[model samples]
Target: MSDSIDSPIIIDLPYEEGGKKYDEDIFARALQTETHQKTGQVESSNVTEYHLRILLHYPAVYVIHAEESHSQRSEPEYCVYVGETNDISQRTYEHLYNDPQNRDDWRLFNNHGNMSQYVITHPYFNKSLTLDIENQLMLYMSSVDHVSLPVNKRVNPQRDYYTHDRFKRIFSDIWLDLHRKNPSLFPAEGIILDSALFKASPFHKLSDEQLEAENIILSEIFAALHLESPDQIATDKTNPADSHLILVQGAAGTGKTVLLSHLFYRLLTQTLPEEDAPLIHSPASAWKSDDKHQDGDHASQRNLIPKEDISAYILVNHDEQIHVYNQIATKLGLQNRSGTVVLKPTEFLNRHSRKNDRHRALLNEPIDKADVLLVDEAHLLLTQGNRAYSGKSQLFDLLNRAKVVVAVFDPNQILQSSQRLSPKIQKLLSPADDSAANPSNNGNDDEPSRIQLDDYNNAKPLTVDVSHIRLQQQFRIDASPEVIAWLDAFTDEGIIGELPADCHEHAWHADDSVDTRSKPYDIRVFDSPVDLFDAIKKKAEIKADGCDGKGLSRLLATYDWEYTSKHKNANDPSGHWNVELHQDGTGTWRMGLGGGDGTDNTSHDRCFCQPWNYQLTDPHSHRKGLNKDQAWAEKPYTINEVGSTYTIQGFDLNYAGVIIGPSVQYQDGKVMFHPENSKNKNATNSRKDLGDFAEENLKDELNVLLKRGVHGLYLFAVNPQLQQRLMDVYEASKND
Candidate 1:
């Protein structure tokens, strides 16, 4: 079955020189009565209701043609305005003769010009259903061969679809009827499929699995909206919201961000029927003074509350992630809408926080103001209150405000202890009945300590269900199944010392020769950290120069070295010294730290310093052979080593050179972490407290750093013993 239906009516528009022309008058009750009302007679309240019923008798679409008053005027063009209105008589009246100061100012209506309109109605017509059909017609007209497209500024609808498929089919039939009347004004069915509006749609080109996921999610949203009533106002004193909590779990690169971006895009474009328009325009009392509808309008008064088209907001913790989402919204033309917003979780809370005294007066909104909240990287949500976040918990705050909350979850992605959720949310995110508590096949030999969500206050009520959906397919990297299994096990399971014989046979064998040219992904181990660094630099340079059709090759390491930037004069920005790298020379080549402001007789070579990834693009480049002036602006990968998850987290790269610093070493045939050598404060959390949160956090950090590479991963161990142990483990797995 085709998705779009062709218009049945064919017409050679006036401009079609020799072509046959079909003419049909699409008269509606509203436009028919407009002539009688032009005498400037005031309508009684009862009579107004009669006209309102006639205009809104059925869900219908109306097209207003702006025609020239003079017959000798240049040949008329189909520069029409397409819209959907339940109360067409009232809506068109306002368009034609409403207050000249604030109403629509179509020049054709301003002059003594004649106007005509076409109406398409259906038996199953409702405001939302007609709006959906109206938008489709607009898209179709814009893509066809016309002298001028409809005067619609944005033809893309703000929604993916209406609530039900039955209504959708009815809308399709309405399109067919319109097309039959004026086939020349519409594109063929195939043209509709390839239309620019369709191409730019967020739901475009989705895989079957992704489409299914979208359908399930949309169905849930539809169900939730159906349960909402017109009388329940979010501005009311009593809270009537029945919010649902949905949990979707996926590891890095599982396309969570993409899905959320599209969801927000479709939501922003959703058109509200006339009755629901006031929901977004301030509180109901505030709209009573609206200049355009100040005449005790019955149609406007009835729409003070919305039944659907509720507002949605997206909250993300990471600046990098939020920036990506903002760019996606802008691409879909959804950034300017007031109903949707993409902001940091902290910023969102601060904006809504009663603490902001200035905004509190007018915006003292109920907790349930937001209808839908989409949280990306929800594992990063904070649990405890701090100076930055005054709220008890972000998860709890979001659930309090939204009727439907969908969050992407990954327990492994939790970076710190402070970024935890409440006990109720944790229980909701726990593995379900069919889920495995642990899997030996993927890698972890032992389970980490279970996260403690029960430590939260028990007084808060928990009313929402924690439905779970897990995405298992990995999309970031292309590698053999054995390699994938091996990498996961190696990262999660403590695989530093001699591996068990059974583990070796399961993942490796001597016959597994690496064929880089034919392999989907490549992995290699280097004896020297410098050699690995050089390979990564070469790949980065080649990719940057477009010699290899790729980019994002980088060098990453454990946070073992201290990063310092000292300036000679506090006031002089140019007096800043190069970023310095230090610690036993175990990591990589670096400028000796003895130089002071270029006065000391010490070698002032290059050193590593963490660059601000979020604030600046191409920050203090690492390219080599730069003159003193050019050195500071080189490519980031040109630098020898990049450390810390702050720079690489939530990012992807083609290849990564990983340096296992001195912090990780083989002692007594077991891998040991010396917390004293680490520079990261977060990493040192394991020092005084061993076999606890800090230790697991360090492990998770290392796993994340190594997995940053998408196409290839190369390892170089700074500690000779650890390096030798790794080689031994790989060698033992070579049983053919």
Candidate 2:
């Protein structure tokens, strides 16, 4: 896991003894006994048969090795082949030598007649499990320095774990046996553990409850899928009508994203290792054509469902989110998998819509298809697709087409007018009749509506009732209960009171009298933005020098800035910021201006304008380039000022320097918002009419900005009155 380019090679995989005793294992006997006992029990026989056949084949993982010298290193390296085969003798023969008819078919070894082979076999292995082992082996081999990469191209496998303890023990034994068989090649402590990867993986890191939620969702999808039969589908030539909609409701920091990541992986790959067993009978193996045409054709004529019968896609709305998702997909190897695409919602809609002429030709025929669709930040689904989607609402369109739709919904996160759900969808989400599904209990105003059983059951054949799951636990902020309670009250009522009695003592507190050094969370109220900027810089430098545990900090602010409608060419004699601070006293400062003339830009000293976070127009070439976010992440500094909701949403920071702009102010003992003062047309336009959507979104944005800081939240306000009000609220909450 270390970021070492040339670490010494350390292998601990021993050669052979105690490796292939799979036939005698208790797991093998238990599977046989269970399969026989369940012969007449049709309800459980399918699952039992799956386990029985997997244990019977007794799969083996083998390695083919050949020594070679490369120019990159002084020492010779080995081109090692690691694979699993049910028939090791035949498979190895084919790999080392050639077929009687086609010599190229056996060219895996290439001119290297001299080779050594090693193997570890197990009785209870499936396609999913074998792929997992091969992937881990590749990762380990790739980690070694001066070692030629493994000859196999591993397909990243989902960590489809066994639910049975016996099966778990069998897999563990195989792993240990392999290490013992080749100690010089497989290091004992070298490769990272799957559990470790699960923790660090963007797709994992969920609580037990969240894991349960994932299982429930999968079970529901499986239930719907089970309703379709191959014979029926082939005859009807119609997409199945058993789709279901699952609504996941959670607020900003409630780990909806983490859940979505887990869902994306689990859905695309098999979830349980034993679920798809009997490799010989699997549709994939059956479909492999060879010179034994009759034999291959006979094998392929089975009633098994192809893996592609179900497909999963993870969809977002923004390009930045797509970039982040694509990176994660590549890391997890999901990017290589067929039927799994991570893209923006618009792209997804366009690809699936029949309206796109190019798509019809590319895909052979236009048909709306997707077994499962996971929509992250569902609140961001556009009510209008900007004419690209032919004006269809993304949510309803997806629900109608996909068999299983899972959405992470947060009403407060809807910042644009285009993202509003229709009235019918809204009613389904939040029924005006259900009292229990009210705002007070769920922490969000809109909750999924309670559907009467008859409503869906009596409706059209394909219609589905929406199921809602609300997640309440907060994971992003490490604050006391009182602090969270205070934040909630502040957002809800624009004020705060004495700290709640149940609140625990933590790093966060706001009394000026308290010792600042003792509190990890330094809640500060600064009158001047310049001083706040200096303090954030000092912290960043300390962090950069390895003095602070909580990593990098960044500056953030309210969208009281006008994102200029006038497009300025990067070559324009005068460079202008797409986002200009629209406050009365604020001056226009362009990013990358470089202290020009040092006159009108006192603001430059306080803001380190980073153009990478937002798109920039190159004036000289009239081209758009230089992603500020990519650049800033590589070389982060507190002074590299850049952040807006678009860039910072769904991301976490160590400390946040917040500047409350003039758009929001303290007036007549209440917080007031002036949309005219804000140039963010989206926020301003989103506020007009229609209840508290705008108000809630604005508060949510600030709440998100404030809670981003893991260790501290530094504050500055354009309006002095609002600054004093916040300080007063913080102080009142800390009083005994």
- Predicted model with the maximum lDDT: 2
Residue-by-residue lDDT tens digits, candidate 2, 133-248 = 55445544433332333234332333335522233333434445455545545434223221122212332334655655665565556545654546556766534454567788
Worst 10 residues of 2 by lDDT: 1-10
lDDT of candidate 1 over 1-736, digit per residue (tens): 0111111111111211122221222222232343234435444546444334433465557765544332433344355566666654455555554434454434433442444566555444555555556666654444332323313333223333443344434544555555555554443454443222322234433434343454445445544454455644644564433466666666666656556655564455533224333332211221221223422221234433232356778887865555545534543335553224777776665565454454431122333357778898887787765567655567766765667788877777766656744455565557544253222122111221222222223324435544445566665555555666666765666555333322122221121222113234656677555467677877666432111134557777776655443324242254432223432334433232433434332323333333322223344344332212111112342354464576566556667778777766677866667666666665454322122365555666677777767678878666777777776765675542
Clashes of 1: 12
Candidate 2 has an lDDT of 0.53
> TM-score of each candidate?
0.55, 0.60
Residue 467 lDDT, candidate 2, scale 0-100: 63
TM-score of 2: 0.60
| RMSD for each of the candidates | 16.5, 14.0
Q: All candidates' lDDT scores? A: 0.50, 0.53
The candidate maximizing TM-score is: 2
